[model samples]
Target: MAETDFDLGVVTAPSGVLVLGMASWIDHWSQLGQPLSERASAVASIGGGHVQDWMCELVAVPAADDKALMVRAGTTTSPFDGGPTIAVLEIDLGLPWAGTAGNEPIILGDLPVDRCGMVLGDAVALDSWTGDSHPSTDGLADVTYWGGYAEAAHLQYGGELIPQHGSHVRGWLDLPPDDAEKIVDALKAWEGDQQGRGVMVAVDEHTDFHRFNRASWTHPLRIGAIEVAGCPVLGINWDNGDHSMRHRGERRFGQVYPVTLQPSPEGQTMMRWTIPPHAPVCDGPD
Candidate 1:
């Protein structure tokens, strides 16, 4: 396949710097958001409802530490039902295939169910950063958290902290305060696992419908702090393996519906950190 070139942007941190100098647009979420819908409607017009899911054209990027081990991902939604999900990750890690021949692409990182949760944000404010418990064993790549409901309220996950009333809806528990270091430390652990073993997508094999991925050992764990189109996000990663869960036979990773993930025309901005769930003791794929 021929490749076209484009410079997405650049990111710099104390760990190191990353460059998005990739020269091609693989089948991705943005394409899924707009192009897929147009195609689906076109197919339906001709009385054809079948559309192939988009394929994840594998590309590797260097981590902030320049290790090429840690992966940053993007987001997308199911075609028919618009749900919140990481569509595709535009990793800035240098392009290097995992296999010896450099042909096999790297997989997504699986955050142990006990240690991660989903996070979403725009340029300034994060839409969801619920107070889940992900106790960090040792300091590492982690996000920050608070010890009060006021701060936890910023997070819109896990707990059922009633909106604005500062109370729970019966069974749901109140948000708890936590140490800020836990955020980065837990991230470090998840990234460490990726380094020790190999990167693996943490999503589950749900083949029926697009659902809010559950947290557990069998399902994919969510973790990681990444920027997509200038928005800060944290969630589960996927691979060709997710096709079965998506239940799309048109082809793996080719289907799309409609989603709007536009970056602020003003530019990228940082958002608050969140305490996702913790990884479980049980183990499966690394």
Candidate 2:
């Protein structure tokens, strides 16, 4: 049986960038190729829970004990100076409903488990991955399943389905407990403050289909829960979906990051990622 450990931390970055976030010495997605998709084809069609041709690896580990079970991760050209700590759990989900022996099952024993990617086991504690949207909206308007999926995962308590997204929803749990709690509190506060607002969902800003950096267009980064940082200082990145960039690119999903919340910002509450360094930073947020 797989040893369950919901008491792990999460550190999410922009999609495609996640592989870069982990400090893996050998950053290959599969034994067949460097890029994950090269070897694993036939992505699951949208709306289908099943994925095919998937495999994963353990890149790196923070603690010696965790080394035995973690999938190492590394970054190539990140903005950060040194390659930071990243716990990777990569899986090559095969084609939708392949109905094969190894393609259908989601397993945790294949790779890393301790430092990062622990939220894959905890539902209630892991912050739901919400793409950028209005503060009033609970889940990403475009990603309608985020809230429902979160509720389902939390309710299920720990199952194969909880952590299946290739790179859609990433959670960060690498900060002190207090800091993590701040994110949780901020998210709860945001949800409670605006439970029934008519917020726009996944409204694309660029029409040219040529521009990049949709985040530059300015949309809402909704808040259902706060994701605290564990590496260093607390920050939150502001963003929304960009069709021009995502229509046919790696960013087809949305993105998230650490940023400085403005003082008394409009629409969304300006939250500060405040937490001291003395507390545990890898457990579930709050």
Clashes of each: 40, 34
Model 1 lDDT-worst window of ten: 203-212
lDDT over C-alpha atoms for residue 285 of model 1: 79
lDDT (10s digit) by residue, model 1, range 132-207:
2222212222122233232322343222223211222211211122433332234224332323531121211221
Q: Which stretches of candidate 1 lie over 4 Å from their true place?
A: 1-76, 94-234, 237-286
What TM-score would candidate 2 get against the native?
0.17
The per-model lDDT (C-alpha) reads 0.26, 0.22
lDDT of 2 by residue, 149-196 (tens): 344333333212212112233233223444444444443333312343
* Index of the highest-TM-score prediction: 1
Worst 10-residue lDDT window, candidate 2: 231-240
Question: Runs in model 2 with CA error above 4 Å?
Answer: 1-80, 85-130, 137-286
lDDT of 1: 0.26
